[model samples]
Target: MVAPKYSRVVLKLSGEALAGSLGYGIDPDVVNTIARQIKEVAESGVELAIVVGGGNIWRGVAGSAKGMDRATADYMGMLATVMNSLALHDALQKHDVDTRTMTAIEMREVAEPYIRRRAIRHMEKGRVVILAGGTGNPYFSTDTTAALRAAEIEAQVILMAKRVDGVYDCDPLTNPQAKKFKVLSYIEMISRGLGVMDSTAASLCMDNKIPLIVFDLNQEGNIKRATLGEKIGTYIGGELNGEGDH
Candidate 1:
């Protein structure tokens, strides 16, 4: 077996990725598939931690834009993330994979509270850790949470799984001629306004010198491919590579 590129990694999944074709709720099939892939990664001797979003259930920014209190709306979004985390935990448990869900908001009945040492201990014990709730605060996106957790846990890279194959200069769905970038620097990503992640998250990753791989989650085994360093998606925060940056 080929050795994986990174011993520890942070897998960032958006809430919409769990929605599948339904586009509103957790799709069991999608969750199961993700669980299976995650199991594969864990079995490969890679320590994996995940940070999930809550857009499928509710988007705090959207709610705030519609007249809800920004903090209240964001808290609701955090709760939605917990729901997604529990659903994922159930699926992984069904697969017989040892998994733990840690929340930032301290819901002891449902899951463990977010503790930096405890989370690292779980990963060290070969258990997958799912980090739910966006930093236990309003105005911080899960993307930022992923960056924060990765830095805390000393992860080598962040696997940013998305619906699209890779980051492009424009909306690929609408523009056939839009160019896909194979690799990008953090400053370039920020200057280009790629929208792959919010500025705060990108800046955090940049400051920490952590690399990110943005790839399509819909494709089976892509996650594992990322772990093995197979060159699947746009690599951000690295030396300049001269391919696919049209």
Candidate 2:
């Protein structure tokens, strides 16, 4: 088997990706497929760390718009991520991949609280680290959490697993004529509000100079392909300079 290009990577999985077509809660078959892919990636010797969003079970911003306290709703969203982390952990274990679920919140019963050193140690030991709980703060997105965690762990790249194939100039579902970018600078993504991630997350990545690969998650084996650096998605980095201009 060919070696992976990146030794360490942070996989940012949208909660919706875990929900499958039903679009709510966990889907066993979907999670199992994801676990099998993760197993392949892990066996390839890539140090994998995952950050899961809570949008499938709870969306804090949406709740806040409906008169709930923003902080409370955000906390609820964090808890939802914990559930996802656990489900993913279980599925991965069935594949015989050693995994650990670490949360930003202090839920000792369900997972270990997030500790930078411990998380790195787990990855170094070849155990997949699942990071959940959204930085343990209100008004912070899971995307930002992924950025902060990836920086703290010094991951080589952030593999953003999206339902969309890549970054498009317009919503592909809404506009069939939308232009897809094969490569984009961070400035382009942020300036265009292309929604690769929230602005806070984008700025964090830019300042750290960590590259991001946004790709379609539903495609079988895509995670392994991304980890192996097969160029299956839009490449967002500071160094591209439109060199491989599409």
Candidate 3:
């Protein structure tokens, strides 16, 4: 098998993806499948860092606020991410892959706090780092967390594993006429408001010149295909090629 083109990459997995078809909470079988895909890519000699969202457990901004404060709601959302990270860590371990869960919040009982140098060192030693707790602050989405972690760890690409196959001009589910973009530039995505990711996260990747690959993780081996430089989805970056951005 050919090695992945990028030496290091960060994977952004939504909590809903972990839920599989049922679409509610963490499904062990689904998580194990994802872990296996990640393991396969890791075996290809690519360093991996994962940033998982908390939407399956909680969406602070979307949920009814009631008496909950905005900051508190966001903190609850961050905790939800920690739960997802721990689940992923366990699943990776089941695949015999070394993994570590680091949180932005200091939760020593469950995992280590986020430390940039330590995260880089873990990746250097071939351990997949699962980053949780959303930048240790409120008002930042996990998408932003992925971008921040990718920049901090010097990852070459951000593999955004979504339910959809790739970036569409409109929500493909609702708009039958929506067109799928094979390739996109950061400026194009921003100007068009394509919703590939939040503007903040997209701008960060653009500034750092980190390519983003939006692909459907539901397809078996898609993650591995992505790491191996296969043209499987929408590629957003400064350059365009059949194998995706280099």
Candidate 4:
């Protein structure tokens, strides 16, 4: 029998990834594909949790830039994340994956309130947990939510599913000559301004000493490969994994 590399993990996703080519809103086909991949990992006895962003439906940063009330705009963004969570939850259920959607903000009609212990309880019972609502507060990104939840749950690693294959020195989309890093230290990520994640989220993960794997979800089986430790993506860790002060 094949074994997973990490017993437990937090899968972080951006809403744009679910948008597909339409460039907005939930794409059921994409959602289903990701759900199937998540189901596969869960069925393998590797506990899983997810943190989703809402850049596709709404972007708090964009709104704030447009002069909207930052707090109000952020709250709206959180609601968008809830929508994405519910969509993914439905897709996972269609795949027959026992899943729970937990939100940092209260939304009893759709999801359970985020409870650290209860969330762990659900994962222990072989259910995939989806965390949404972006820390239940403004001024925090979903990346921070992933880091905070991973630390609270003591997850072994964070699987950051992105459109890009891995972390690079420059944006690969614009810089054809960009260099991709196979691995990096947290300090390096911070100094390089890699933009893999926001500074706050990266700092939280660094402080907690949690490792993160950034990989492309477009490639089939990458999720499974990442969970099974196939060495498919760029791995980021603290000083222990590379040279840098934590």
Candidate 5:
């Protein structure tokens, strides 16, 4: 069996990925499939930290903010992440994979509050750690949260699991001519405004020298493939000079 290139990694999953083909809300089958993939990686002895988005349940920034403040909307978004985290936690447990859900906010009823030492300990013990609540603050996206967690946990790579197979020059769904990039540099991503992640998240990874691999999670075995270092998507690191140049 192929082993992962890194001993520890952080996987960033969007809420929609858990929704499957329904395109909305939580889907048990999809969550179970993802959980099984995660279990595969965990069983391979890789310490995994997952940061999930809540866009399927809510996007605070995109909600009907007719009378609501931006901060309020963002807080709601954070709550949505907590919900997703709980769901993922349950799914992982159902697969017999030891897991813990830690939130940035104080939600003792649902999960433990985010403590850097505790989170590290969980991973050290081979328990998957699910990070939720989006930094426990407003004005930050889950992308930034994943970057922050990766840096804090000293993870070697960030697995950005998305719906698209990889990063494209344009929206692949709409642009038939959009080209997929195999590799990209932090400087290039920022300069080109690729939106692989928020600027803050990209800058954090750049400064920390952590690599980010963006790939589609909808495909089966992709999580394990990524863990084993298979070339499947756009890789952003400090070494890229151009497309497919990693």
Candidate 6:
């Protein structure tokens, strides 16, 4: 068997990815597929944690634009993340993967409150930890939460699973001639406004010296491929120019 490349990783899942084709709610089929892939990684002895977004259920920025208080809207978005986290936890459990859902918000009934050491301990004990609630604060995106949690847990890399295969200079869906980046540095991404993730997230990873891999979540075995350090998507780290002019 091929040994895993990174022993620990943080997976950042957007809510839309979970939504699948339905586009506005949790799709069980997609969640199940994701869970199966995650189970494979967990069984391979890689410590895994996940940070899920809530745009599929409620986007705070959208709500705020529609006249809701920004903070209140953001709080609702956080709750939506908690809901996604719970759904993922259930799917993982069904696959027999030891999983724990921890929230930044104090919701003792459903999950444990987020604690740094406790989260690390859970991973050490081979539990897949699902982090939810987006830093328990408004104005922060789940991307930022992933970076912060990865820093706290000392994860070697962040796996940013998206619907698209990799980061491109232009939207691949809209531009058929878009160039897909094989690799990118955080500074390059930020300077070019790549938008693979929010600037806050990119900046956090840059400051912490954490690498991120943006890959297609819809692809089967991608999670495993990423963990094994295979060249399956656009890798972002260090001081390198965008290498996608091919």
Tens digit of per-residue lDDT, candidate 4, span 179-236: 9998898899999999989999999999999999999999988898998888777989
Once all C-alphas are superposed, what RMSD does model 1 give against the true structure?
2.0
Off by over 4 Å in 6: 241-246
Tens digits of per-residue lDDT, candidate 3, 77-185, equal 9999999999999999988999999999999999999999999999889999899998999888899999989999899899999999999999999999999998898
> Cα deviation in Å at residue 139, candidate 1?
0.4
Clashes of 5: 0
Better of 1 and 3 by lDDT: 1
Candidate 4 ranges with C-alpha deviation above 4 Å = 240-246
* TM-scores, all models, native as reference: 0.97, 0.97, 0.95, 0.97, 0.96, 0.97
lDDT of each: 0.94, 0.93, 0.90, 0.92, 0.91, 0.94
Global lDDT of model 1: 0.94
Query: By how many angstroms RMSD does model 2 differ from the true structure?
Result: 1.4
Q: List candidate 2 stretches off by more than 4 Å.
A: 241-246
Rank by lDDT, highest first. Answer: 1, 6, 2, 4, 5, 3
Query: Model 4 — which ten-residue stretch has the worst lDDT?
Result: 237-246
Tens digit per residue, CA lDDT, model 2, 178-236: 99999999999999999889999999999998889999999999998988778788999
What is the lDDT for 159 in model 4? Answer: 95
List of clashing residue pairs for candidate 2: none
Instruction: Give candidate 3 misplaced runs (Cα > 4 Å).
Output: 64-67, 239-246
